[model samples]
Target: MNTTHRTIVSRRARPAKEPLSQEVIVKQAFLLLREEGISGLTMRKVAKTLDTGASSLYVYVKDLQELSSYVLDYALASVKLPDSDSEEWKNNLFAALISYQQVLYKDPGVAELALTTMPLGPHSLALSEYLLKQLAASGMQAASAAWGLDLLLMHVTSSAFEHVSWAKNEKRSFTLMKEAYLSADASQFPFIHSHKNELFSGDASNNERFLWGMEVILQGILKQDQ
Candidate 1:
């Protein structure tokens, strides 16, 4: 039987039998996540993987959400944020964002967790503070900086996760999208048809697109200052 379908009892009634630590639980959870992705990382599944009852896991982890928080915290703690004190705030901001996205790519679904819950993990808070500091020093108002942080997180997480979804689903989405774009009615989408090449042109790297998007955001922020 698949491990997921195997019958497992909760430890609430039975005494805990596993001699594992929270560290071990977190480590094994990471493996499960890497092997099965988010949907496969569950408290019950983790207990089965660890050869313990589902209730035993509660001693180390409250729920799947808390388990995810632990893993995300452990992952973020290892990343080195770009220097947050640079006078060139725009450069610093974009570099930090790129680094953040790359880190998210290291383990899929962690970015979505961060984006939705905005967890107060120590490392997450540190990055948030760094971004706020850089934005504030760039002469952005408190309210604007607050919203700006949310905007950047939403953009990076959504964009990177979309890439992950495409990879996971084995979707040749862009090629199909290009075909549709190029085949659209010429009279209705004259400009889109004309610039189809430029619009669809990319060498499978999001770096240039990301940089351009950041530049546009920075320009808008600068306008707010003026």
Candidate 2:
């Protein structure tokens, strides 16, 4: 029986999956940002999600800021620039701004990153160059176009962050917070109580409010050129 028995040997276990590339690491970071707020995102957490060690991440991203820069650049890439010959510059610009807001809204924590960082990567530079070109084509002087693009980008980032804050707090649900705001003494704050309807008229109407602001800015820019 001993001579008839043959042992079957199994091959060595497959090697573990290769560590993520820098781009994959950064992409996962953005996913974590969207899943958990910015405060929840950490190098350790990112590594855990990627099934790798934190040391593996440092090979690509130097620090949190660099990771953030990557995420912002990726997010900004979603903003599509209009064709060079497209005549509706204002409309195209407006579309780009709206698209930016949509991207931020889809990933609220991204707004936080976008607010603190300046776009410096190829993706960012491309967007900036495209915007500047669009503005210049619309008859804006080079300096005005450059500065205007800066102002508009700043405004979008700030506004998106504010919206993200509101979304995070659930302040849009006027049912709970609205009552507190309305309960304030009418005599001391007549204006506050009087405007409660307008202040919290509809819950979760950020899209409309954002569009209104965008229109106002677009109008101002158009008027300046006219």
Best by TM-score: 1
**What's the TM-score of each model vs. the native?**
0.79, 0.76
Candidate no. 2 TM-score:
0.76
Q: What is the C-alpha RMSD of each candidate to the true structure, in Å?
A: 7.4, 4.2
60-133, model 2: which lDDT tens digit per residue? 88887888888789778787766665487777777777777777777888888888876547788887777777
Model 1: lowest-lDDT 10 consecutive positions: 111-120
Candidate 1: tens digits of C-alpha lDDT, residues 1-226 = 5557666778787876657988888878877877777876788888898888889888877787788887777667755677666578777787778888887777776655555544535887787887888888888788888877877877788877876777766477766977899888889999988887888565557577766666777677668766
Q: Clashing residue pairs in candidate 1, if any?
A: 11-55
Best by lDDT: 2
Candidate 1 colliding pairs, count: 1
Q: Model 1 scores what on Cα lDDT?
A: 0.76
